[model samples]
Target: MAKKLSRRLQELQQKVEDRTYQPLDALSLLKETATAKFPESAEAHIRLGIDPKYTDQQLRTTVVLPKGTGQIVRVAVIARGEKVNEATNAGADLVGSEELINEIQNGRMDFDRLIATPDVMPQVARLGKLLGPRGLMPSPKGGTVTFDVAQAISEFKAGKLEFRADRTGIVHVMFGRASFSPEDLLVNLKALQETIDRNRPSGAKGRYWRTIYVSATMGPSIQVDVNGLRDTKLAA
Candidate 1:
């Protein structure tokens, strides 16, 4: 059965017309429609031409949002000896070696981002069943599996985000909060666009960009003009 839309959501939906909007205009509308009592996150849903099922067409990478993600990102590190201390000194919220793996195996997920050193990855691989579905599986491409644990933790805490095209060839990411100024949001969005373009897969053929949309966490989706977003240049 289809669930009914709330009265507030229904009214908000009416305000959005059936047409695409420029990037800035779409962001402004997204902010305006974010009338929830609490601060809402700004999210982007992008469709791309590449299919992720093929190895050559797969896309997995990270982008650093200049304005920073609105919420605090709790970082966890799984390493041994010196790397463990390195993570702690770099402000890791939780640091452990085998004990950390055991905690996660028993369903103790206390952190938002998990960083595992290269030496401990063999053990970390066993937790894939628990972490993969949640997009928490650390991989070299995502910058999560590395010898440089401290730098990885610092970057993730400072608004660095890992994203990839799903099996359906769509990318979904949270850029910032609705309370942020439209300019800040635009800067982040532009950065995302550049990152995706720069990471275009080898087998991606024909038109790479399909469509782009932005919306507040609970607000109606606002279509962003693809070309307009691509042409947008951030001020130096």
Candidate 2:
């Protein structure tokens, strides 16, 4: 284990110095991970896709350095019925109303994230200028439009990050970074992985967690295999 650890460390150091690392082949990617769990020093970004157009089993996960995403999310919740208090108490930037329509008209709405209950969809639907192009508009795919406001707000507060797959079948998330010690990165990664594993949509039709790799901003990719991670992958 020590010998393997030393070799892996040298390889990583060389890669960092040379900066020539590329995406790892499936098996080797997970086998040669940089940490046991993930790093804590860095923030994480999550990507998720809930397509009304597609079935389950098609989700994919790939990691990038948090440094690359360059955005810290500010969450907002549009609440009505009984959800207003729950959302505010959970630390969300919140507003509640049928009159929210008028509030958005003045164009004061500004935030990185948006969530709404079923009751307020019409209000949000009317505010495309305030929430649309910015990707702050919440949707069912992003888990922000739902009957449960409290649950959604807490997820945001806990750094529940999200992303979506593009035309090329790749989804990108920033799971901490190298500036973070291996342990910091590890924890963030675990949080991300478990969240996905537990949230399998009841109707999901394809493979989940298709693939995962960890890389730094402008860094090479390291595929992380949960089971094989340990002495062999750790730095000596």
Candidate 3:
């Protein structure tokens, strides 16, 4: 009985590690799932938060998502000088203190999201009301609040995404919609997972990752129970 229970627990844990869902390669599993329209809520999207660990080379990772973020971003910044100019030149929608901070504070602005630099963080606290409730605030965990304004803005326009975990300690993210090709979805899914893994906290409970699942926009949530996810390395 003890052995049986241990095996069952191990099996369940493996599903959490099965972070990738490759449909083309696993047609048998695909047939078991009924297709549906993409979900409208970002709540079902999967995301991983990882620590950069002060590494310089991991600065940027460019990936062409098969399915986009499904939401539009109205980026705002608090930086000045070349950093400010650099963000606007790249086509960010908003770039000034009065325009960005003032509107966010009054709770009268309409924008999808935001990204800020080291110098700009002080301004964001004031706009907490406008951006906070809407889930548009630039957070430390999201990689939006950094000294590197150019990279932040560039990735924002390029669909660089930030995600937070829910009460269940799980993050749902869109790999792609049902209409997307398997390859595109695969690349994106892997990229997002890698970024999250890099952000995992060393001081997490028992094992920082308690659970994981994946679903397409407007699709059912499927837990990943694949080859290697079940076996994870502990932080040194």
Candidate 4:
């Protein structure tokens, strides 16, 4: 049976052509095609040429969105002593030491992003079964494990995002809200792309970026013309 699309989605889909578009054009189209009443996020889906089964082929890192994610990120910091105070003073939504870990283990998780100090990892590690599955585990690679709890908390609260390729080698990240100007979205997208490009796996062979698509939270995916997007004139 054919999957049914809503009338709004159907109409929105009509605005997207079958061919790939320039990055800026694709972003503009994504914003134009957003039909959600609430502010929808602009997302990018990149398919890379790599097998995650190989450790060296995995891509996991963080990117600071130039224009912000446009969504408030609730940050949780698990630290002790002065670090806990530092995190709280740095604007962390929730901060605590062992008690916070107990709360999480007991099924109380209210924050979107979780940061922890290096020394507390021994305690936080116990929650791996719960946090790992939710992508909330603090890893040094993700910039969530650090001594400067304040910097980590501030960066996350200021639109830092962690991304990793899934088992299938696809990375989906939110660039900004559909309501943002096309230029803003374009900047954020380019920043994310550059970061991903810089983090390409050394073990990966052949073409790296297989495909790139942009879409709004409730909009149709628009194929991005890779070559055209690389054009200095348009990308600039």
TM-score for each of the candidates: 0.98, 0.55, 0.63, 0.96
Candidate 3 similarity to native, TM-score = 0.63
Question: Candidate 1, residues 9-84: lDDT per residue as tens digits?
Answer: 9999998989999999999999999998888999999999998999999999999999999989999999999998
Q: Which candidate is the best by lDDT?
A: 1
Write one digit per residue (lDDT tens) for candidate 3, span 155-217.
766666666555434564544444445444445555555665665555443444444555433
Worst 10 residues of 2 by lDDT: 18-27
lDDT of 4 by residue, 67-155 (tens): 89998999999999988888888999999999999999999889999998999999999999999999999999999999998888888
Off by over 4 Å in 4: 232-236
Ranking by lDDT: 1, 4, 2, 3
RMSD vs true structure, all candidates:
0.8, 10.0, 9.5, 1.4
Question: Where is the poorest 10-residue window by lDDT in model 1?
Answer: 145-154
Query: Which regions in candidate 2 have their CA more than 4 angstroms from the true location?
Result: 1-73, 98-109, 128-133, 177-179, 194-211, 218-236
Decide which is better by TM-score, 1 or 2. Answer: 1
lDDT of each: 0.94, 0.54, 0.53, 0.91
How big is the positional error of residue 68 in model 1, measured in Å on the Cα after superposition?
0.5
Clashing pairs in 4: none
Whose TM-score is greatest here? 1
Q: Which stretches of candidate 1 lie over 4 Å from their true place?
A: none
